[model samples]
Target: FMPASLLATGSERIVSGLFLGTALSISSVKIVAMVVREMNFMRRDLGQIIVSSAIIEDTIGWVIIAITIGIATHGRIELASLAFTLAGVAAFMAFSFTLGRRIVFDAIRWTNDTFRSEYAVVTVILAIMGGMALVTDLIGVHTVLGAFVAGILVGESPILSRHIEGQLRGVITALFMPVFFGVAGLSADLTVLVDPELALLTVALVAIASLGKFGGAFIGAEVAGMSRSEGIAVGCGMNARGSTEVIVASIGLSIGVISHTLFTMIVTMAVITTLAMPPTLRWALGRLPMGEAEKKRLEREEVDQRGFITNLERLLVVVDEGVVGRFAAYLAGVIGAGKPTTVLRTSGESEADPVEAAHLDEIEKGAEQGREAAKEADEEPAHEAPLTRRTHDAPLSAEAVAKEARKGYGMLLIGLGRAVTAKGGFSRRLNEVAGAFEGPLCLVLKPAGVGRQMPRLGPGSGRILVPVNGTANARRGAELALAVASVTGAPVKVLYVARPGRDEPRDTVSHRRREAVLKDIVALADRYGVEIETAIRSRAAAADAIARQAGRNVALIVMGVARRPGEELIFGETTSGVLQRCPCPVMLISDARLRRDDEGREALRSGTGTG
Candidate 1:
């Protein structure tokens, strides 16, 4: 304000300067995110801090802009009116973040589940944004603040998958955003800059914006205990005004607080600063050194990028009202605590089977437990809303499940009381359901005599046993085990199950292979921030070793097995042995392969593999 006052003298000087200064004070969050992503610094400490600071600045900057507009609206700021406006703004923000967020989440979930039309959720999101914007406008503030709050609320919903986010971003980038910037750009005329006085003023504006933002950010970074290199990168990063300046300047112009000349100057400063940010920030960040802790964190994050459990976008649970179903729900809740999980309750063989309220209650209770566990672990539930959706549209059948499978599920979980037969093989009903979904699946089977003794598998319940053979399937199972342990705080025991004849000689090569496999599992545990105990047992059948290690205290045994081509759901001799002999509940995660019919297998063997 003092800098702009050098050129102005009248009553309008103070208000104009306030508007222009506020416009220049904010940084562009979108631009910062793009640059960070481009530089692959999004997961780094410095990158996170820079992005978080920009977000906070943008939020607070919008509120200040609203208040300034409120003062301008009243012609001359009266203390009573100003106080009332400030109170209203605070109340609105508090309500939006607290109760209003819940309302928005519920609305989005309902729209997503109830509608069969495409883009129904997106439609409801826009309506919610418009409604909130109208409320803010009624409260004498700008509509953008309300829209911003609504976007945050919608983004927090658990069901807002990356696909939906891309849809929204696509429409904005393709249509609305281009028009917005085009109009803003066309309004600025370079002809007015030919005047020497205005040209000099524009230069002065750029200098002031750069120096003030850089110095303030550097000082603030140092005060927060950041190193000198980090402070320099932050200052350089925050200097870009970009879209934010255009928005504030446009608002000021529309409200008659700033003239066209001042608006053009602000836009020009925005352009120059934004153009200069990338190179400067890159140079500044290049000088910073990575600590040992940061390097380890980056390695873990890289593992997460290629992990199976971490990349599951959605989960489907097929269950019944029996104990097995309830147990499956509990495990599903833990595995999918951070993803959207849909529960499809089997109403029995007859179409007239009633949907049991008890089953629905179990699903909710299990999901609640999972949410609590996630919160206790300080794990970020990317999508915290829309925990579970229950469906009972059709009776249990191949056709019914096949229909649901078309909706794109990453993984399926099946748990029914009769899923296993007396011969310890998968029952016909279980095979039917499993064949309907072609993706990866986990089958929760109840051991003989488990009956009503199976307790809720939650935090501190018991130990988890994972058998590893150093195969891709084994690693996948280990990853799932680690995820579950991370959420439930269960102690994990990774047992290296060596084949009886293959690992006979404990030579150097064998020892090195075993060590490498165990080390890989340990690294996976670190990715999920879980500690585990390792055990190596050889010169025994893989199934026998696994069953012996799964003692009474072991609550669950999770194994990853590959599906063999056959008319039924077959998982080789080893998996069958573990399923028949292990006392605890077993979770079998199978590879992405469906059972091939007899004709298909015969054709391949006879050298006539055509369809």
Candidate 2:
């Protein structure tokens, strides 16, 4: 028998060990929480895995804690009590699996309809989770099991689950989780490994734990037919114990299963594993061709969703040395600089001619002159005085100039040729710039030598012309045009064409339909707080009617390019026809460019406007 003094000393040591174990457990959890919070697991695959592992570890730790508590209270471990506890846990899980699905689905649907707010739904979900946790804790299973089970149930309700996940993700993953880990690190005492044997044992245990997880995952991957490199990646990834291991260590310490020294060692192991994963993953990924399949899948997905892709906020501007073209290009550049600007060469007159050859001589000459002008402008500090000092009037017919600007240009810019020359062949380019191009046209003219300076329009410079037909593209075009109008404080003219067929006459129904469209335009105009004009014309060709109306005074004409199934016109024939006949600069707006709300707004706002 032991002496009373010796027994008392042994009891004191055991009590001290229990206290140290509990402290270590708490410390481990804190460390894990810190790492996970800092790492932002929600955005990464590793984070997800770490979170999952942590959940499992937490559950196991809680079970051990409960058992330790029972042992301490009873003064001995009872086999029957353990058996009963195990049976109760299994029974509770079975019930949850069966009834939890229905409850979760119904609850989510009800919450969605009643609350109408995502936050409300999240609140309901948390309530259910908390309730489930309470039930599990009362049943002596573990609150963590209940939390996990609740997560699984909620996960089944994809929509609600996604909403709650999104709402909670930042708070839980970014803030609280990291703080917990940092707190754990602060609580850890690294001096416990002063004994050489204890230090070696701790290291061995960490190695064994890491190898067990890594080996299991790698072997599983290999058995599932992964390549050697892929299996290795899986192993390396799984070896990262991280937050989960720390949580497990904490739980063990709380339950009196692990010593303070052992817990510190485990925490160290977790940190090393977490730090090593990134480089190991990079190396493993470099050695594997696993990304090929993923790349192909993403490419296919993009193709499948091509119709949904919106146009970028970019404007394609055509430029040349001609006065009108240069002014238009400069204006476009200024407005679209915040966007994207594409310059195309349109000097070559013939459609059949090779573009490179036709523009080669002109391009080279322009490049040389541009370089010289840039150098002179750079040397002259007061270059802003006036370009007219050295500017020689390059004589060209307005028609020729407009035609050159039309090639590949989304909008045409030209100075209004003298009205006296309007009927004359000399003002052909001005006519085209004003009416012929199927896009927005800017006609700028300065009296002979006074160069046209871009005037700033107040509030209303984004005047746009949107011709709607109720089609998706037409609606998009209208919205885009409106956005532009809003930005520039420009008025919108929504022209809905009602063409009378050669056989059919314009009737009451057509008139009513036209009236409805006008009303819509007016309503939208009012909503956006801009000027709106609606026109319905009886004509043979819808494109011609629309163009004629649009050409009247608008800064830009926005029209949809119709695309049809099989034997489809590559370029909208109607748009091309309008481009050929319209008097104003035409914007051959395609569905491709006006997909996004922002892009649509930018495109519509991108032109010279007279506010």
TM-score of each candidate? 0.83, 0.43
Clashing pairs counted in every model: 0, 31
For residues 1-611, write the lDDT of model 1, one tens digit per residue: 33453332233665666667788889999888888878888889999999999999999999888888887777667899789888889999999989998888778766765677778878888899999999888888888888888888888776676777888888878997899899888778878789888889889999999999999999999999999999999999999988988988888877778777777888999999999999999899888888898898789889988898878877888987677777787778777765777778875423223446555566566556667755676655544434455566555888877777765578999987756665568888888998898789899887664554555555678788999989989999999888878766788889998757645455678778989999999989987878999988887888888878876588989888998866689898888888778778888898886437787679878978643
Measured by lDDT, the strongest candidate is: 1
Which 10 consecutive positions of candidate 1 have the poorest summed lDDT?
2-11
Question: Tens digits of per-residue lDDT for model 2 on 383-480?
Answer: 11001001113333435434433322343333332311222122343333333334433333322322233333224443456777656566555654
lDDT of each model, Cα atoms only? 0.80, 0.49
Clashes of 1: 0
- Candidate 2: misplaced stretches above 4 Å? 1-78, 116-118, 161-163, 290-295, 302-611
RMSD of 1: 5.5
Whole-model alpha-carbon lDDT for candidate 1: 0.80
